[model samples]
Target: MPFPFRGFFLAGLLTLLLISSVQAQSVPTVIGARATLEPWSDPIEALGTLRADESITLSATLTEIIAQINFSDGEQVEAGQLLIKLEDNEEQAQLRVAQAIRDERRNALNRASQLLERNLAPRAEVEDTQARLRQAEAEIQALQARLANYRLLAPFSGRVGFRNISTGALVTPGMALVTLDKLDIMKLDFAVPEVFLDVLEPGLILTATSAAFPGYTFQGEIATIGSRVDPISRSMNVRAELQNPEMRLRPGMLMEVVVRRRPRQTIVIPEAALIPEGERHFVLVIHEEEDNRIERRQVQIGQRRPGDVEVLEGINKGELVVSHGVQHSREGDNVQLLGIASDETSVRELLESRRGQGDS
Candidate 1:
């Protein structure tokens, strides 16, 4: 090898190293957001079922032929309103006969009393007539009481379901006649894991949603909590009451329930800022001094929401964090901030905007 050739080779190698160092020093552009203190709530989610506040299946207590149907199906009825009538011709005739016998006995007793007072009749004969009058009066009262059963009355104010029996149909004892539901308020029943038993209490506010009504949320409060937890499922039953003025929520509907336990101030950051490496999580915190250098810090994460995550440790309020271009950032690397994300921008919206830019 010649001396001149060796020197030329060394000079070329030094030029290449200088160019690589300059490229590494150039700042990489990234989008970032500042850690913020926000009101955070922990939500307990569970599936629930809706029920009527009051419901019953109306049935007949006696076997009788229906003579008339007083109410139409699905009609709203007030308490004590007559809903059906059975054949009562025989009961009416029996009542009339008992009344006639009662009148005769009363007249005989009065005549005997007057004779005894005038000294024309013995006191023993007047006493026998009085006893007969009392028995007749008892029969009349018994007959009247039996006649009242022939008409069926509503037990409470509610909406009636379709009647199963028509006019002149014979209905046996305990046979279902119709269904009544009190729909002004709805009862929501749900079960929660036993772990949450300590937090369960009456008057906890919750929001419910059903597939039947998309995007509509029904608000309710916890009405009761079960005293005992189920051993098999390790869950406790909870009941909540919701006012249903529109009557749109029906019984047996499956609802998604969300109970916000409590609110607290916590350090929150955009979900995009998190960098997961196996079991550990990290974020790139940017320092504005000295050409905007980035520092990698491990974080302890807590509850996660739609577009943000709760930072339990390793982060502070008002610290700049790299939200976008996290994959391209390295520790101690200089970065140029393209934009500082507003607190209102969600993780989903941020992802969509990045996707759109990639597509263009």
Candidate 2:
């Protein structure tokens, strides 16, 4: 080989060795997370069924053919409105007899009083007449109550179910007349794992959607929580109230309930930066400013959100956290942020992105 060729080849060989040495000296890992202030309110999921706020089965007070069906089946009835009428002609006649008897007793009692005052009638006769008058009045009231019951009236305002008897069909007292339910407000009954029993409370906001309702969702709040946990199922029963002004929701509809807790500002750290030691949590945080440093921070955990855990203490917002190679890092060490190759935040972003796609 000529002198110039040998020189160039030797130079190239030296260059390759230098590059290899540089590559061997560096190690890179993905650093997880971006600094974010987490809001409180963790996401909770549970399954349940929709129920009516109020439900009742109606029965007749008298045994007779539904004489007159004033209100149609499945109609909304107001409180105390006449819903059905039994054969009340007999009741009306009975009421008239009672009234006449009462009137006669009253007049007889007045005459006996006047005759006693004149000393022509005994006081016993006047006392007996007074008792008869009171007895007659009580009989009148009884007949009036029976007469009123002959007509079935709505006990409360609600939507009526289908009628079992027609105008001419006979229905005995306490028979299945129909059902009345108040549906303006609906209830959702569900159970949550016993592990989460302490975190749940009344008035917690809940969002629910059902496959039957498609894209529509119902918003509600925890109305009641069971006092005791279910021993057999190891779950807690929770009830939520949702508005149904349009009356689109029905009883017994299945739905999923999402309970959201109260929101408060909290410090958050990426999951990759967290290290567990003896039931305690620690995070590797990068010290920013003069002479880059690293520290192992003991952090208290609170409500956890997606991809991150809320740090109740030991970390602040906007702090530089070392999420990569945290296991190998020690506290009070000189660390350069760029020296470690970072892929941690990107991995989380990628997983979240794919999750969004799957959900859609």
Candidate 3:
């Protein structure tokens, strides 16, 4: 069938309208930003755990059975505090015998030398007495050392773990008496990817928090960074020292850490302004004119914080960016500047005020 001139004109107009609607892009997307400046700080977040810097398993240096458990489990003990006492009766008895033998030998040697000087004893006999005295002295020292090994004393000031044996129980060498840990100063051990290696080093400050103790922030310093990165994880071990003078922090509590690498003044835009589609990211920048009509311009992005992203390559200062209603306008379409610039300013002010509160 053939259409008349009027019908053909009407069909052409409808087709044009459909094509334009399909190709239209959005404009006036919600926009906001923070004032920018030159600074050099990048904050890297990490997960770690609280741990004691020094921990060891207390064991008997010599073989013996457990006699009396001196310290209670999980008790804070001082340096050289009695932790465990083993069966040492046999050792003490032997030590007494050894002391007697040494004393007797020493006395005999003195008497023999006196007699030799007086020409009353043979020279060979005096020499034999001297030899016996030396042997006896050596035996006494060995016995005293062995006797000291029966009792286990805390090597350093720390908290003792569970008692591994009850009183009168028999234990041997290599048997674990208890665990001890010095928790006054804790080690915050964690790992960071090699990509961030340059930003971390000794003396840098850090703040950490734990869910166990809510709202309490802990402070620390970067004490060590491993020289080599692990091949499997491509991460290097990092250690921070935290003062736990009250001994309130436990040895294995999970932690969250934020290490500031670089601090720089930068322009930050609201995340709402960003329009992400597949691999590409963009934002609807505000185009102001004398007519008060809003227009759109695309922008690139950099890093992101809680609700803002850094402007890396796109946009500039004093330029307005439309954050809300970006899906409605186009490149040259006329838009009413529904609100004043103060709307964007208020949002930025809110974020800064919150940050200030945290600082106080």
Candidate 4:
């Protein structure tokens, strides 16, 4: 059955074994990113609410019929602008009567003074007439002061809200007529943990964002800090002022605030390199160990930004970390380094591009 046939079969079996061994020895390729040292500014994030710099609800002081309404709804008014006028018909008649009596008293006082100068009337009589004329003038002044209450004037310059009462409607004292708010500048109030009290100060730059306006950021500064921290919450209240020329931010709007206290230099790495398990984090670090092997090292992380995370410990500058194909890697496994990612933005873009491809 022959020696030549047996030799050919053995040679073919050896060739198949050699090919399988070569395929097993081939290294797995993976993308790696280096830890970089960059200038990072730590941000104190907090929730806040926006408020108008100045706000007031206008109301009447006296009960009377509204004779005239000068402003319309949502109107911008100047300071001391005449906003409403109440009917003052009776007050006007009373003022006229008081003026007429004052005129009569003045004529009597003049005659009495002339008589006294001619020695026909006593000095007491002239003094009494002068007193009567002064009393009449005082009465007229009091009446005029009372008439001022019938008119309501704007206390400040701002935009006015809608009024509930009409021109002829009778409004009582303390009834709300309209609301006025100065929206040129807005006040943002927020609370931060008491630990940040030392860094909190006026004029610290901050940025705020709201869900109402996506992708838009409003810049402001810390205007004031509360004097005392709340005993219950253990947080201090902070106020910031923002210029709202466009009036896009309204009062009572919820905002996400980020206060940039100062800049710091720290180690950062691409977020894709981080592997979180439970409460701990790990990364596959590629180093020269029998032809570039991966070492699973635990890492301590800090504040995170877009596409990058702060590496507080367990990693050093310029260390190569596996950014892609982590699932195919293990500790002490030989890997082929395809490319080193230097730019964090590019790494993020590459990850997103891959994710998009997978999704499709």
- The per-model lDDT (C-alpha) reads 0.89, 0.79, 0.75, 0.89
Q: Which one wins by TM-score: 2 or 3?
A: 2
**Per-residue accuracy of model 1 over 188-220 as CA lDDT, tens digit each:** 999999999888778888899999999999998
Q: How big is the RMSD of model 3?
A: 12.3
Q: How do all models score by TM-score?
A: 0.65, 0.65, 0.63, 0.64
Candidate 3, which segments miss by more than 4 Å at Cα? 1-41, 61-63, 122-124, 263-360
Instruction: Indicate the TM-score of model 1.
Output: 0.65
Question: Model 2: per-residue lDDT, tens digit, 1-360?
Answer: 999999999999999999998764543322434456755677789899988898888787767877887776778888898887888887788888988988999999899889998999999999998998899899889988888877778888889988767888888778988788888999999999888877888888889998978889898999999888889999989999999998888899989888986646777776677888998998877766645566678888876655678887888777777776676567776554543323443655655665787699
Off by over 4 Å in 4: 1-40, 106-130, 263-304, 307-360
Off by over 4 Å in 2: 1-39, 267-360
- Candidate 2's TM-score: 0.65
By lDDT, the better pick of 3 and 4 is 4
Q: What is the alpha-carbon lDDT of model 2 when measured against the actual structure?
A: 0.79
> Per-residue lDDT tens digits of candidate 3, residues 1-360?
446988998899999988886553332333333324334356777888888878999776666677777788789898888777778887788878888988998899899999999999999998998899899889889987776687678888898887757887777777777999999999998888999887787987788889988999888888999888999999998999999988878899888998866666677666666777886777655556544355455567767777567777677765666555567655565554444234345655655665687699
